[model samples]
Target chain A: MDIIAQLFAGLSLGSVLLLAALGLSLTFGQMGVINMAHGEFMMAGAYTAFVVQGVVGDAGVSLLLALPLGFVVGGLLGLLLEATLIHRMYRRPLDTLLVTWGVALVLQQVARDVFGAPNVDVRAPAWLSGAVEIGGLALPRTRLFILALAAVCVVALALALRATPLGRRIRAVVQNRDLAEASGISSRATDRVTFFIGSGLAGIAGVALTLLGSIGPTLGTNYIVDAFLVVVAGGIGQIKGTVIAATALGLMQAFLEYSTTASVAKVLVFVAIVAFLQLRPQGLVSVRTRSLA
Target chain B: MRPRSTSRHGVTRLATASLAALGVVALSACGARVDSGSAAPTTAESCVDTSGDTVKIGFLNSLSGTMAISEQTVHDSLQLAAEEINADGGVLGKQLDVVSEDGQSEPTVFAEKAGKLITSDCVAAVFGGWTSASRKAMLPVFESQDSLLFYPVQYEGLESSPNIFYTGATTNQQIVPALDYLAEQGVTSLFLVGSDYVFPRTANKIINAYAQAHGIEIVGEEYAPLGHTDFSTIVNKVRSADADAVFNTLNGDSNVAFFKEYNNAGLSADEMPVVSVSIAEEEVGGIGVKNIEGQLTAWNYYQTVDSPENDAFVEAFKAAYGQDRPTSDPMEAAYTSLHLWAAMVEKAGSFAVDDVVAAADGVTYDAPEGHVVVNGENHHIAKTSLVGEIGADGLIHTVWSSEQPIEPDPYLEGYDWAEGLS
Candidate 1:
């Protein structure tokens, strides 16, 4: 029974891990320019949901509004950031890191000034707040909801990549930017679109996090490392690899938590991820895109 | 009990940071040479002098990284205290000059900041620290530097430092009292849950010992990572474990999922009561009072702790921060610590660390919580304990209390089964 329950827990947590890492993998893996401000982008989305909830006073309505709004906000922020700071440092990935770190600081300070360094309440809408009993095992409806939501996101993203013109352009740029430009695909526009999509995905993850708990300035920082670990361990820049890696990580974490101390389990999870990365530095998937290079 | 050691680099960095915080004033203070040999040493003979003009104080918090959210509050409150003190004509005829340093939420960083506070700023006393890990990291720094630190948060006891003054309630005064209340209410079996960290681990150890000595059967024990969510499995275990009560010490937003899952499991306070230490008033609203109402909580301060002192404290906090901003246990402790430090300084009539520490033996303060006295020997405060029920207003109401403030006993000196545990 405990094992079954743990499996469920693993899936729920894994879903989140998957969501958090997908965008990080794209921006960090393909671009090779780290986005330390990635977590703040997620925070912005969570706060957006919280703000909508404040006005609507209805969970379902607030969440429905928040999801799209979070995506838009995230996309806009990404375009602005890429335009202002990141684009200028194409040759200096390390410098981009420092610049993004600065951006994170500014965003955090702004959050503190606006939210006053306190955790804000992010209510789970009434419809989703309850639990469903699965053969006497209690499962939070919200967790199950998020798990399903993640599945939908994965499928949609996969389809978009396979079936859309924008996806082809993105893949082209991801594979070989110069070649894509020779083929009349604007690499710069592709980068902006990719950034927007990645940032928007992060925003959705942020909204999902609010459903799990409180939304604070430090909210994104908490999960950002774990998210990065998943991205690295699975296969950088590969969504399919991210899903597989996150699931493995999640199961490992859940089992460890079940059998040992939670902190020790976390430490163990980190150790395993690092060890896995050591063996497979390119992740489960190799970077084969010429445009991306 | 674990003997947590402070890191070497952590100490040096703390010293450098503290010095940086003190600015030019700290440099000059460190340059002072005075020898009073007096009882209090107001200006002369002190290891560090402040009589010339401004006194440097340090605020150490993790301004970056994971621990920032929690630690920043302590940092902000300390700043608020310093600002309020400066507004009141400074301390002992010298204006306060605070140097701020970020601990980066790492224990090593905490050690570094402590050293900086001692060596660079030459601060008379330093304030701020939230986690047991950080406190343990800085314990040796304060002792070795021969400085004073006011730690403002309740922690797992079985530990104390001579150079530190703990404003937070110790386990005997907080956790134990909750246990006593549960026992009184006929709770025979209990489940232990907490975050996997120093405080929770030590707290569970104490709970296990206490349970054995008291004939209470321990049903199950569980732990999660610091920021872990997904509580379905753990909630299932609790449901099947059939414990009469749950003692939760899980920190951060994990509480939201835990309580939500607990509620989903149909385990209400009426069925299997959850007596929590970590989920305070600030967290109650976040976790949703509907999901956790009527649940038991153990702490030293509640906005509902009745008294003129509490009233003024609440009002003053609202006035200082905002009318809507609610004060929680840690914030109250942080506020109490500043005044207590002031009392010790007033008693010693000096800014010298040794004198204030020496005069700290029996110092007492009319804190917002209540009248708490300092135990000079252990550096922990004597405090009352209250086990409150979560109210619909998103606040906790006191349902059971110690009736009197308990003495500081971080080492569990009264327990026989916990022999040599401390």
Candidate 2:
């Protein structure tokens, strides 16, 4: 029963990690640019949820209105960043890295000034505020709700990335942007849409995190490192690899915590991931470039 | 490379290293010349001098994290106390000069700041620590450097470092009294819940032992992660357990979640009461008055503590911050800690860490909490415990009192069942 309970906890936490890293995996791999401010983008989404909740006191009303709001805010922030800064450094990845790092610091400071340093509570809706007990096993209903949300997101994202016209275009861009552009794909518009979608996905992650814990400026930073680990461990650019790595890391964390302190458990996760990365520098899975080697 | 340029780089390296050494020598030398009470030679000495015109102290707190809202009050109160002392012609004719540092709310950062306070800044004593982890991290640095630290937040006891003084109540003085009050009210069974960390785990260990020794039975013990906000499952477990009371040790936003869920589950204070040690005036307001009102909280001081010293403290704090700003237990302890350090320095007659430590055991200060005396053997102090019910005005009304202060016992030595536990 405890192991089963632990698995649920693992799944719940894994979903949050997947949500957090989904945008980073896309932005880093497809665009060939590292978004160091990705976590801060998530922070913006959490704050947006906070403000929306404030205006609408009813939990149901707030959540009902927040999903699209989070996507728009996150997507707009991404668009603004790409237009004003990211586009200039697209060819110079290191310059983009430094610029994004600076942008991250600015966003953090802005959040500190606006929200203050205290952790702000965002209440869960009335409908989701209970737990189920079955044969001596206790489970938070909220965790199950998060799992459902994560599944829906993953499916919708997968279908959008695989089955739709834009999905094929994104895949074409991912495989060979020059070839796709030569074939009339309009790679510039594709870049804009991809960056927007990537950022909006991260914003959705932030909203999920706000539900699990209090909203704070550093909330994104906390998950960002772990998300990078997930992306790196799962093999960058592979969504299937991300799912595998996130679930594995989550299970490892749950097991480590049962035997030691939470801090020690986190340290173990980092160490284990580092060891895994050392063995598989290309990651758990990798894409094939058509060089005959 | 030319030999001349190599020699010049080498000379630059040598000169810079020597200057750093000289800087250290100068700092250690000033330890002998501090301007407070006179008790040491004016030349090179092992101790800091407090006999100068202005005694130097340090205020260390996290100014920028999850702990800032809570720790900032302690910082403000420490300054307030220093100002009040300087106004009264300083301690033993030395006005106070305070050095400040931000701990950044990390354990490693606490150690670095503590080292800087002792070795670089040369403060006579420093005060402030909210989490047990930060205090533990700083303990070795203080001991190795032979500097003094006055930790103001209540913590798990089982500790007695010669160079540090804990002005806040230990489990014996605070948690024990809270349990006793609930037991007196005929709480036949209780549930224990807190954030998953060292302090709460140690606290629950002590609580379980006390419950077994007494007639009370523990229904369940639950813990959430530090920033955890979900409590639906835990709340359901508590409701199913049907304990007469819940002893909550959840810190930060977890409290807000637990309280809201408790209310949502149709649990009220009257049917099965909630007793908390961490939620004070500052936090009660933050957790929302509606969720926490009617619940009981335990602490030594409220903004409503009665006495001339408390009146002065309240008025002066309001004057410093504003009338609407409230005072809580930990901040009062922090203010008292600085004054107590000053009193000990005056008694020892020097800021040399060991000299002041020798005089720390039984030093007394007429503080905001009313005459808390330091126990030199242990680093804790004697403090009265107050059990208060939260009112709509956002202040805790003292409903039960200890009558006299409880002596500091971090290890729970008095209780037979707590044997070998510390």
Candidate 3:
């Protein structure tokens, strides 16, 4: 029962990672742009939820409203970033990296100025406050809700990326941008939509994140490195690879942390990842094309 | 994708190399200065300026980073104290001039700033250190410079420095009294949860000794990195252990996550209560009152303490800051520290370090926490220990308190079991 509970805890954390990594994977897979400001976008979403919650005194209803509100806010901001900054730095990945880091720092300062340095409590609704005890296992309602939310998001993203015409356009652009443009797919529109969706997903992840911990200006910073690790370790763009990698890493961290200290667990996780990378330099999954050979 | 990453990796390597080179250069520059500076003779006469009508004191705290949230409050209270002193009559009939510096929540930064405060700023004394790590970092600087530091935060015992005055409660005053409270409540088994740091580790050591002597079983002990948010696994361990209570030494944002997870695990203060040493009235609101409404905390003072001194202090604080801002233990301690310094300086009739240290003995103040007397031997002030229960209004109310101000025992010489634990 204890093992089961620990596993559940791991999975619940994994679900949040997966939610965060999905957006990162999509953007990096398609645009090849390292959005270092991804976590700030998540912070934006969390703050949006905070603002919404404040405006509407009811916690449950406010969270429901904050989801879509966060998406719009995060998505619009991403669109603005793609147009004003990321678009010009497409050919220079290294430059984009530096610029986005600057952007993240600026956004963090802006958050600190607006919300103050202290962590703010975003209360889970009364209905989601307690655990559901099943025999010897106690499953927390908040974790269950986040798990369900992540599952829905993954399914929706997978289906949309695989089945829809928009997905086809995004996939075509990823394969060959000029060719897709020649075929009247308009790679620019695809890039805009993809960036928007990716950032919006990060925002939604932020909303779920508030249920797990206190919200602060650096809230996104805490998870940004781990999210990047998930994306990088999962073969950059593969959804299936990201899911497996996140769950495995999360469970390993949870178990290691239980046995030892948090810092030791983190160090071990990084060492394991490095070792795993040595074995599989191309990550767990990668797309192969004739040009690569 | 493979070709792109190889080039990107090369760029990253180049950037990292240059950054490392810059860091090495900067480090050597500081090292060279330190070597020359330490070789010189040091004296308090050349350190501070006393000819002027204004006496300067430094206030060093982390104004940014993870510790900013808590340290900022301490900084504000220190400023308030300085302002109050200046308004009436400053220390030694000189206007209080505060030289503030940000510690940046790093031990190295604390040490560096402390040195700068004593040598460059030439302040008579420095106040404000929230964490044990920062206090430890500043210890050597203060000692070597023949300067004084008034640290206002509860810390692990087994430490005493002639250069530093601890206005906050030590382990024997706060942690041991907390254990006594739990024992009196008939708690036979306890779990330990804390942030992975010096204070928590040391406090737990003292707790282990106390438990062994008092016939209480320590079922489990766990530690998370500072600023760690995940508490699911630890919470699971707490539930499975079925201890009568949990002694939480977790600090900062970790408490928010821990309490949230504790509540979500269907645990409450009524069953398996968590008596925390870190969480105070300021943190209760941040962690959410609903999440930790009935939780217990061990401290030397609370905003809701019903004393005329406390009432006046709280009112003055709210009037200065705002009505909603809560006065906490550290803030109260910081306020007391300023007055304590003033009283000592007046008694000594000088701002010299030796004079101040000499007159520190028996210097008492009617502080917000009640009367606190300076222990000349250890340089810690005697404070009344209070065990508070967090109420729904996001405030902590005293459920129990020490009959009198607990004497300062920084080395824990009073307890036989704590002899080697330090």
Candidate 4:
């Protein structure tokens, strides 16, 4: 019974990791832009939910509205960043990293100034506050909701990237920018759209995150490194690889934590990732391309 | 080209030789220190200027970073205390000149700022430090400079420094009373959950010793890293262990996550209550009342404590800040610390460190928490311990009390079970 409960816990935790890392996978993995301010975008979404709840005074209704609103808020911010800063430093990954790090600090201070440094409470909807007790296992509705939300997002994103015309353009630009431009795809426009979608996904993840953790300016920093780890360890630009890696890491964390301790479990997971990277630096799934840069 | 290269090598060698000579001289100069039998080195003479109409005191706190949210409250309370003192005819007939510096939520920064506050700012004393790590980092600096610091936060015991005054409750005044309350409530089995830090680790050690002596079975023990939000697996362990109650020592934002997860796991205050040491009135709102309405918290004071002094303090605090702001245990302790310091300076009729120390023993103050006395030997104050239940209105109301103020026992010297533990 304990083992079964542990498995569900792992799956739910993996869903959280997958949700947080999905946007990073698109921006850092597919776009090849190191966005250190990606976490701040998540903070923005959480704050949006807070503000929505304040104005609406209804948890369920505000949550429903915050999703789309969070997407727009995060998308606009990403579009602004890419146009003003990231566009000029496309070829300088190192410079982009530093510049975005500075942007992250600035955004955190802005959040502190606006909302204060303290963590704000976002009350959960009454319907989602209870747990489903099946015999000996107690599954929280909040965790279950997060799991379902992650699944829906993954399916929607997968379908959108495979079946849509915008997806095709994004793929073309990602594959060969010069050829895509020659073919009249307008790579710059595609890049902006792609960044918009990626960061918007992050915003949705942030809105979902308010159900589980404290919402504050520094909330993003706690999960940002884990998100990057999932993206990097899964193989850049591979959604399927990301899914598998997040689940695997989540299960490993659960079992290790049960056997040892949380701090020890974290150390072991990082050590394992380092060892895995040393063996396969190309990650779990490598892109098979013939073009030489 | 060969002659130029040779000249460059000779210049480099000469510079290296001079640098090595300077390093030797510096090391020798440092080696002339006297052993004072304490961690502090040979002290510098006091540079505090008290001849003027104003006496400076420093307020060191993390105004930014992860700790900013909590430390900012301490800073605000300190400011309020200073203002109140100045209004009531300043300490020892001179107005207080305050110097504020940000600790940046880092221990090394705390140490560095402490040194600057003593050596450069030349403040007679310093106030504010929330975390044990910050206090530990600043301890040696205070001792070396022979300055005073009044730290206002409940912490693990087994520590005492002459140069620092602990206004907050130590183990006997807070944690032991909490355990006694649980034991009296017929909780025979327990689970321990805490943030992985010095305070929790030491507090848990003390709990283990107490439980062993009292025949309470500890079913499980788990620690999450500080700031770690996820608590699913740990909560699962708590559920399966079927402990009668849980002893939670989690600090900061982790409490919000822990209680949320605990509630989601179908745990309740009625069946298996979690008695937390860190959650105060201010934190109750942040965790959301719905998630932790009936939860238990152990502290020296709560905003809901009914007393004329407390009423006045709360009113003044709300007037100074906003009506929405809540006065907590640490904030009250900080306010009391300044008053206590003023009393000591008045009793001694001087601002010198030695005079203040000589007059500190048995000095009492009518603080919001109650009438507290300073134990000058250990440099901690006697405080009453109250166990509070979080109410629906987002405040903590006292459900249990120690009945009278308990003396500070930082080293647990009175307990036979705590022998050789420190």
Candidate 5:
């Protein structure tokens, strides 16, 4: 029974990792942009939830309103970042990493100045407060909600990428930017839209995270590393690979932490990731492209 | 397309990037440890310009970074204390000229700021440090410079410094009384949950010894890194262990996440109450009162502490800051620390460090908590311990308290079970 319970815990944790890393998969993995400020975009979304709650006063209603609002807020911020900075430094990955890191710092400081340097409260709806018992093992409703949310996001994103015209343009640009440009597909516009969707997904993740974690200025820093880890270990640009890697890592972490301490578990997981990457440098999956650069 | 050559180059670049990342990690890990080797104290002459009508004093707190949420309250209270002191004929007839510096939530920054305040700013005395790490980092700087520092936060005991005045509760004052309260309430088993740090690690060690001597069952013990948000697995363990009570020593924003998860896991204060040492009035709002209502907290003071001194402190604090700002234990201790220092300076009739240290013993102040006295030898204050319950109004109401202010026993010298602790 305990083992079953832990398995559920692992699934819940994997959903959280998947939600956070899904955006990075598109921006960093697909676009090859380091996007260190991706976490800040998530922070922006969480704050959007806070602001919406303040205005709406009803937790449930505000949450529903904040989802689309958060996406727009996050998407707009990503668009601005791409237009002003990332577009110019397209090929310079190292420079993009440094600049985005600085942007992250600046965004954190700006948040501190605006919201004050404290973790603000985001009340979960009354319905989401308790757990649903299964075979005498209590599963939290919040975790279940997050799991459902992650699944919905993944499905929506997969459909958008596979069937949508914008997704087709994005894939075309990624495959052969020169050829796509010659064929009259605007790579710049595709890049902006891809970044917008990716960052907007991060924003949605942030709003969901407030149910489980702190909502503070440095909240992004806490999950940024883990998000990147999932993306890297799953194989960049592969959503299916991300999903598999997140689930595997989450299960491993849950079991390790159950037997050992959290600190020790974290260290061991990092070690395992390093060893895994050593064996397969390209990650769990890789995109095969005929294009040179 | 030049695919084969490009793919080869990509693999090499990826390997080099991973190696560089590892190198950075290794270097940062090395930088975490501070050099604690003993060195002879520098007999630096006091540069405090006491001849003028104003005496300079420093207030060092983390104005930014993770700790700023808690430390900012301490900073505001310290500022209020300075203002109150200056209003009451000042310390030794000289108005205080305050010099404030931000620690930036880093211990190394705390040490550097301490040094700057002592040598460069030439302040008579400095006040503020939230974390044990920050205090530990600033300790050597105070000793080496022969300066005075007043730290105002309850911490894990077994440490006493002559150069630093600890105004907050030591182990015997806060944690011990809390354990006693739990034992009285018929809690025979305990599960320890704390952040992985000096304070919690040392605190849990004392609790383990106490539990063994008292015949209480040690159900389980767990620690998470500071700022770590996830607690599902830890909560699962807690539920499985089914201890009589939980002793939480988590600090900062981690508490917010922990309580939320605890409630979400079908656990309530009635079923399995968590006794947290760090959660105070200011933290109640952030944690959401609904999630933590009726939970127990152990501290030296609370906003609901009924006393004339406390009433005035709260009123003045709210008036100065905002009506919404809640006064907490650390902020109260910080407010008291400045007053205690003023009394010490007046008793010694000098602003010099040695004179203040000599006169610090037995100095009492009608602080917000109570009548607190400085134990001259240990430099820790003797104060009452109050166990509080989180009220619906986002404040802590005292549920139990020590009859009198317990004497500071940082080394746990009085307890036979704590013999080898220090």
Candidate 6:
């Protein structure tokens, strides 16, 4: 029963990680930009939610209003970054890495300056405040909500890519930018929309994060590395692979932590990830693209 | 030949880069001081500018990083104390000049800034250090420089330094008394949960020994790294352990997540109460009263402590900061430390470190918490222990207290069980 509970806890944690990494997968796998400032976009979304909460004055309504508000705010900012900075470095992966890192630092400082250093309390709505308990198993409603949100996000993203016209354009550009450009698909426009949606997903992840813990300037930073790990380990451009990897890592961490110290568990996870990467360099679900060749 | 020569230069550059990186890694591993290039000391005699009509003292707090939220409040209280002192004709007819420096919430940074304050700034005394690590880092610097440090935070007892005066409650004054209260309440088994740090580690060690001596069963022990929020694994462990009570030493933002999880786990105060040493009124607001309304916290002072002195102090603090600003034990201790230092200086009729140290014994102040007296032996002050319940108003109200100030016992020599442990 304890094992089941612990695994359930891990699944919930992984769900949040998946939500956050969905954006990274889209940007890094599809857009071919490192986007080190991905975490900062998440921070921006969390702060937007905080701002909306202040305006609404009621927790439930504010949170409801914040989801879409956060998406738009995060998406528009990502588009702006794509135009001004990221677009120039699409061909230069290393330069994009450095520039995005710089952007992340700048955004972190801006958050600190605006919000102050203290962790802000974003009160969970009354309806989502408690937990649902069975005979021997208990699960927080917030965690369940986040898990559901993650599933919805992943399924919706998969559908958008497989079914929608915008998804087709993004897939075309991602597969062969030169060919997509020649076909009058407007690769730049696709990039903007893709980047916007990617960042918007990160924004929603940030909102889910606030439900679990206190929000701070570096709230997203704590999960950024893990999200990167999920994207990398899941294989580039593979949403299904990312989900599997996130769940596996989360469960591994929780179970490992049951026996060992947290720091040791983290080190073990990193070691395992490194070992796995050595075995499968192209990741779990490698896509054969011209870029890979 | 030109290509070979360029390759050789590249090899040399790579070697140099690797060597520099190795040196940095090695130095950081051993916690060795890297010389931070700052201004050279330009003074022949202590470098203190006592010739001016102002006496300069340093206010060192973590103005940035993880600790900034907590330390900023301490900074504000320290500022308030300084202002109040300066208003009261400024510590021996000279206005107080404060030299503020940010610790950046790092121990090395604390050590570096302490050195800077002592050598370059040449402040007579430096006040501020919330964590044990920060205090430990600054200890050697103060000792080597023959300076004074006024640390104003309740900490794990087992240390006493002549250079530092601890104005806050020691473990004996807070932790042991809380344990005593728990034992009196007939708690047989205790589950210890804490942030992995010096304070919690040491506090748990003492708790372990105390429990052993008192014939109590230890059900479980767990720790999470500082700033870690996911408490599900640990909370699951706590739930399964089924202990009579939990002694939580988790600090900072971690408490918010822990309480939320604990509440979600349906663990009420009546079933398995948590006696926290870290969470206070300031933190209750952040953690939410709904999550931890019935929870117990042990501290020397609370915003709801009733007294004329406390009323005045609270009002003055609220007037300076804001009405909503909750005054916790650490903030009150910081405010009291400045006045205590001033009183010591006045008693000695000098601002010199040795003089102040010599005159610090038996110095009493009608502090906001209550009447506090500085212990000459340990350099720690006497404090009353108050166990408070987290009220709906997000304030901690005292439900239990010692009724009198407990004498400072940095090295728990009074207890036989705490002999080898300390």
Off by over 4 Å in 1: A28-33, A90-92, A267-281, A285-293, B1-45, B48-127, B264-266, B288-291, B341-363
The digit string of per-residue lDDT tens for model 2 on A185-207 reads 88778888989988998888777
lDDT over C-alpha atoms for residue A29 of model 2: 49
Q: Is candidate 3 or candidate 6 better by DockQ?
A: 3
- What fraction of the true Cα-Cα contacts (under 8 Å, chains A to B) does candidate 2 also have? 0.05
DockQ of each: 0.32, 0.17, 0.48, 0.26, 0.51, 0.29
Ranking by TM-score: 5, 3, 4, 6, 1, 2
lDDT of 3 by residue, B183-267 (tens): 9999999999998877888888888989999999999999887778788988998999999999999977888889999999899
Evaluated on chain B only, what is the TM-score of candidate 1?
0.86
lDDT digits (tens) for residues B1-422 of candidate 1? 01102221222233223223433532342233222112122232224657677888777878876667677666666777777777888788677888888987667678777776777677788888887878877876776666788899899887777788899988889988888888888888999988866788888988898889888999999988666666766776788899989999998878887887787556788889898998787777667778788888899888888789888777876787677766778888887888788878889998777789888888888877788889999899888888889998999898987878899888888768777678
**TM-score of each candidate structure, all chains considered together:** 0.84, 0.78, 0.94, 0.94, 0.96, 0.92
- How do the residues B136-233 of candidate 6 rate in per-residue lDDT, one tens digit apiece? 88887787777899999999878889999998889999999999999999999999999876788899999999999998889998888766767878
Clashing pairs in 3: none
What are the lDDT scores of the predictions, listed in order? 0.77, 0.77, 0.84, 0.87, 0.88, 0.83
Off by over 4 Å in 4: B1-41
Tens digit per residue, CA lDDT, model 5, A1-293:
88988898899999999999999889977787778898899899999999999999999998888888888998899999999998888766667778998999999999999998767888898889899998889999999999999999999999998899988898887777778888999887888999999999999998998899888888888888888888888887678889999899889888899999998998898899889988987789877777775
Docking class of 3: acceptable
Each model's fraction of native contacts: 0.34, 0.05, 0.46, 0.49, 0.53, 0.29
In candidate 6 the C-alpha lDDT for residue B208 amounts to: 97
What candidate 6 gets wrong by more than 4 Å, as runs, is: A291-293, B1-45
Cα-based lDDT at residue B26, candidate 3 = 38
Q: Relative to the unseen true structure, what is the C-alpha lDDT of residue A175 in candidate 5, on a scale of 0 to 100?
A: 74
lDDT tens string, model 5, B1-422? 21122342263344347435844864463245455324324677778899999999999999986688889999999999999999998998999999999998888788888888988899999999988888888888898888999999998877888899999889999899999999999999999999987889999999999999988897999999877788899999999999999999998778988999999999999989999998888888878889899999999999888999999999999999999999999999999999999999999999999999999999999998999999999999999999999999999999999969999999999999887888
Best by lDDT: 5
